[model samples]
Target: MDAVLTNFANGDILAITWRPLLAGLAQTMLLSLLVIPLGAIAGLLIAALFVVSAGLARVLLMVWIDFFRAFPPLVLLIYLYFGAPLLGYEISAYAAIAVSFTLNTSSYFAEIFRAGIEGVPRGQWHAARATGMSWLQSFFVIVLPQGTRAVLPDLLSNIITITQLTALASVVSVPELLHTAQLAQATSYNVTPIIAAAVIYLALLWPLVRLMSHLDARRYSTKLSAAATQRRRRQETADE
Candidate 1:
């Protein structure tokens, strides 16, 4: 066992794969940090507009969201990478992923956020307004918090999906984690790098999935309790 462990820890597996993997890991992290926040913020703004807008404006927003949401991020990345230079605009692979992720995930974020906002009780809005708060004030103060909490599990799922999509950057030669792992495996003629990368990906993502499940469970429990309380109150009132 010690010998097997020693072999796994040293030589080509450790030395050759680690540097490239680290580089890939950095790029993956950088892309994630950039895309997640921007996508979330853009989605928030669009969702707000969806709530406030009516008629033509709402239709336009829906069209935009659907158009982007329906697009595969890989296709969008391909188009941006290969199609841009034709338009006399040069773009790097990293730039392509950034743009694609931002646009595609924004649509998802917008939809999820709107769902969250709508899930909040309408009474909350009236309560805020009763205190002489403006529409915007009520949204930022009361609605946003509850809405965000309501949609957090969905948002976390999206983030996890987006994090994995970073692997798609490899198609454009972006040298992300998967890309480096592929290169390492090809050079060493060993499956170790491939296995290592798989492990790394799992290590990074499993905790997120577990957390999302926990939050979803908690949210469901809260709703169940609230419903039970409401039913109990109604029963007591009827008896009275």
Candidate 2:
């Protein structure tokens, strides 16, 4: 342990490594924050189009989503950075990472939202139509609200996923945490900065992970009680 501590303390960690690491950490956090809502907005927009009948746009969107989700993010970053130049559109590394993360994250979010919207009880849709509401009106007014609530916990979890994925931005020279850590490691010739990066990531993600757990627990509790009440009510009706 003494040897380990001595090795860890070898370099001027605070003076040299911390600044760059913090800067990288800040960049990663900002990128994650920006990506989550942007991705969600993109996802929600695609999901809204689910109301339409089958068409070229819908088919194409599904294919795009499948393509990105199936494509590895790191590889996507590489392709976006290099492939775009070949197509006569040379984007910066930051823009490439942003576009890649957004599209990748949006694909998953889109599927979740579509499932949420579709999973909404069919009876409600029928009832809304019976009440003279147009299908679109019923979808936006009735189904969407419930669907969003049902998927809220999962959406938060996906945001956590995107946060982790920001580490992959290093591939495209995004100067994020891992990249910063690598630079520090290279300069200092000590592994402490890498450890620091891990701690920083843990500190950043742990709270959000706990919150997701709490949400899952609360959701399960609510579902269980609702089910129990439903069963009791049916029993009472049958008994009477």
Name the candidate that leads on lDDT. Answer: 1
For each of the candidates, the C-alpha root-mean-square deviation to the true structure, in angstroms, is: 3.7, 3.2
> What's the TM-score of each model vs. the native?
0.88, 0.85
Error of 1 at 197 (Å): 1.0
User: Which pairs of residues collide in candidate 1?
Assistant: none
- lDDT by residue for model 2 over 1-240, one digit each (tens)? 867864575456646788899999999998898889889989887887754637988888889889978988888889989999999998998788788888899988998888889889999999999999997899889998998887878888899999999999887778899999988888777888888899999999999899889888887898789999999999899777
lDDT of 2 at 78: 91
Model 1's TM-score against the true structure: 0.88
